[model samples]
Target: MTTIARVETFLVAPRWLFVRVETDDGIVGWGEATCEGRSETVRTAVEQLSELLIGRDALRIEDHWQVLTKASFYRGGPILASAVSGLDQALWDIAGKRYGAPVHQLLGGPVRDRIRVYGWVGGDEPDEVRDQIAGRVEAGLTAVKMNASGRMSPLASVAELDAVVRRVAAAREVLGEHRDVAVDFHGRFTLANARRVAPLLEPYRPLFLEEPVVPENSHLIGELVRATTTPVSTGERLYSRQEFLPVLQAGIAVAQPDLAHAGGITEVRKIAALAEVYDVQLAPHCPLGPIALAACLQVGFATPNYLIQEQSIGIHYNLGAEVLDYCVDQQPLSFVDGYVQRLTAPGLGIEIDEQAVRAADKRGHAWRSPTFRHPDGAYAEW
Candidate 1:
């Protein structure tokens, strides 16, 4: 038996943690469990998980998932789920390599040869929305996503409300009729503000209004979705199928599952299956690293209702490093008119540059996501 021999983690630059798993016969697999702004915390969780994984058979992936997840009295959250998710991806990587096929092939073969992907534009909030949209358009991208606001107050004045509408209008000007633009609310809006803003942006026809309210307030999603002609999308914060079921029932037009935090390939595949029944589109939320993007591609290739993918090639969050920086063969992530070609190599397809990863780990980061505050010294969702 090819027992799991070693599990290692490299905390790479620009906020990502790469997981490398090896077997007795020298077969290696890689996965990403990056909980951006919390890489070190997830790293510690992975270290603890390694104790449970070290002597197991690398091929019994499902069994390992069942044990690593359910064996614990408390299971499912960003930390534990993110830890298991990376290992799940690595195990699937090993299985694909063992079978000499792509991960999608092992998941019942490819449903589409290539999947369309959307590029991210703007910083925490868009400063030069038109210029940024133009840049993506010039880069041969047909679709792009941008934050609706940097830090939105519970209710805003006319100036703030007008600015939000203007940002969406600016993107529409760059995209025109053929291309698409998705506006991400980032859960920065209160139900009142979201209700007011969703209607204003309808004339521009955004691909979807993402997370008008946070996942915790998901019971209110249908209110936002029903209020707008534009679609509503969510799920990067959601960790499992159960967390997603109620959201799916809320009439969301699209579902965005992050492969690294949502139970990796094992649970996300089931989540995708559930989304299909509701006629909701799939757009895996991957703003982390290469492995997460590759896993998203694997699911995107096999799933029929997949809408598009979000890759962090040059996303604003990448402070000092880019997604392709860790890829051995960067061509797999090359965009062809905004669409990533289907990966064909065994395992997760793209190779990780371990040397670069280890060197970056030497200068590890303590990345923290930005915090938001109201003028009155109260905490606000970021």
Candidate 2:
């Protein structure tokens, strides 16, 4: 029997926290616990949680998840859930390596041969939007996701509303009817604004409107859902299965739980199952590094209700280092015709460049999400 040996956390460039777990027998597994701007806080949480895992059996993934999540008196939020998410991923990786199979195989085998993926396209400017999306298409990607607007007002003016429509129009024009484009509101709009904008986007036929409203306004999602013919997708801010229940009942067409923030593969698989009951599709929200994307792909390959994936290979946030920088091999994450073929490698499927991770940690960063404020000095959701 392989006993747990060491658990370590590394803060790498471009705002990502990676968890590394090794067993006494020498097998190592990696996971990403990135909680965006809160990387430092989540890193501390991973250290505290490591105390519960240091001497236990590495194969006891579920038991560890239960204790790591429930043993504490106060539980279940992005920090704790993100910490558990990374560790849980490492454990599943270990289990897969231990059994000589891929994580998807352990999760009841693959339901699809390959997973469809989408890349992020920036530039609120019309020309930038068109050029960026054209580049994605030139790369052979079939789908792309772009933000609706930047720091939008609660009640958008006609010009602001028209700009949002124009951006989507630009993306759709570049993508053509053959390819797809997803619009992300990023919780920057009020419910009324979302309701107003959702209908206008219908003609462009966006794949979906993401985070149409913030997670806190989930109860109001149904109203927006009812108002729009376009599919409403959300859930990146939501962490647990219970939190997802209300949104699922609210009639969202797609669920976009982030693997790093949504309790990793273990909880997300359950979330996929729950979403399936509501006839909703799983499109794991992954705008982080390779490990997080790998974990999302593992669940996507095994999940029947999955729609598409969001990858951050060239996202704007990746300034200091790119996703493939820490990876030893990039083939596992290579995109062919807009989809990543099934990852056949064991564990999380991609090999991490440990030396690169260590070197990056030595120069660790204190990354924070950009704060937004309305012109009148009111706090705005970024």
Candidate 3:
């Protein structure tokens, strides 16, 4: 049996975390955990979880996931689930490498030759929406996503409603009707405000309005979805299929499970199939690094109802390091026009530049998302 010899975590730049697993036979696998703004916390979680996995047979990916996920008396929150997610991905990486095939081939077979992907365009205010989208279009991207609004109040006024619609309109003008654009609500809006804003953006025809309300209130997402003519997208905060099932049944039109957060290739594929039963589109949320993106791509290629993928190439959060900065051969992971071509290489497909990862790990990061407050000093969603 190929037993896992060592498991290591690297806290890299721009708030991304990576995991490296090595077997007794000298086979290595890489995976991205990338719990943004909490890299150190997740690093500790990875180390703690590694103690449970180090001596286990590397090929028992499913059994390991069951143990890692359910062994805890209490399980399935972001930190623990995200830790299991990266380890699960690394195990799949090892399994693929051992068999000399990419992960998609190992999971039944590929349903498509290539996967379509989207880039980011960020601005707290809507003024930069048009020019930023134009830049992405000029760079050969056919799709882009932007935050739907800045810090919104529980009860938004008429001006706030118009502002959100205006941003989508600007992107729609740039993208036209044929191309695609997605709007991430970032869970910043209250239920009333989110429902009110959703219909107003329908004229612009966004591919989806993501996470209109926080996942804590996911029971209400169905009400928000039915309240809108546009498709609702969410699931970055959701950690498992149990968490996802209710939202899918809640009538979300698109499911946006992050591979790094939702138990990696193993759980996301299951989530995709569950969504297909509801006729919901699969768009794995991956605004992280290359390994996470590669894992998302493998699932995308095999998923029949996959919509489009979200990548962090040139995204605003990538301050010190970029997506391809840690890649050995960037071309294999490079976007052609808009889609990432199907990866034929064994394992996760991207050759992680170990030296770059190590050097960046040394530098590390103390990244945190900004906090917001209303005028009355009450907390506001960021």
Q: Indicate which candidate wins on TM-score.
A: 2
Q: Hey, what RMSD does candidate 2 come out at?
A: 0.7
Local accuracy of candidate 3 as per-residue lDDT tens digits, 169-234 = 888888997789898899999999998888888888888899999999998888997898888989
lDDT of 2 by residue, 155-198 (tens): 99999999999999988888888999999999999998998999
lDDT of 2: 0.93
| Collision count of model 1 | 0
Candidate 1 least-lDDT 10 residues = 123-132
Error of 2 at 65 (Å): 0.7
Task: Report every candidate's CA lDDT.
Answer: 0.89, 0.93, 0.89
Give the best candidate by lDDT.
2
Worst 10 residues of 2 by lDDT: 311-320
Residue-level lDDT of model 1, residues 1-382, one tens digit each, is 8799999998888988889999999989999999988878999999999998898899998899888889889888899889899999999999899889999999899999888888888843344888888888888789999888877888878877888898888889878999999989898899889999989999999999988898889889888878878899999999998999998998998999899999999999999999999999999998889999999999888889899999878776788788999888899988898788899999999898888888999998888877889889899888
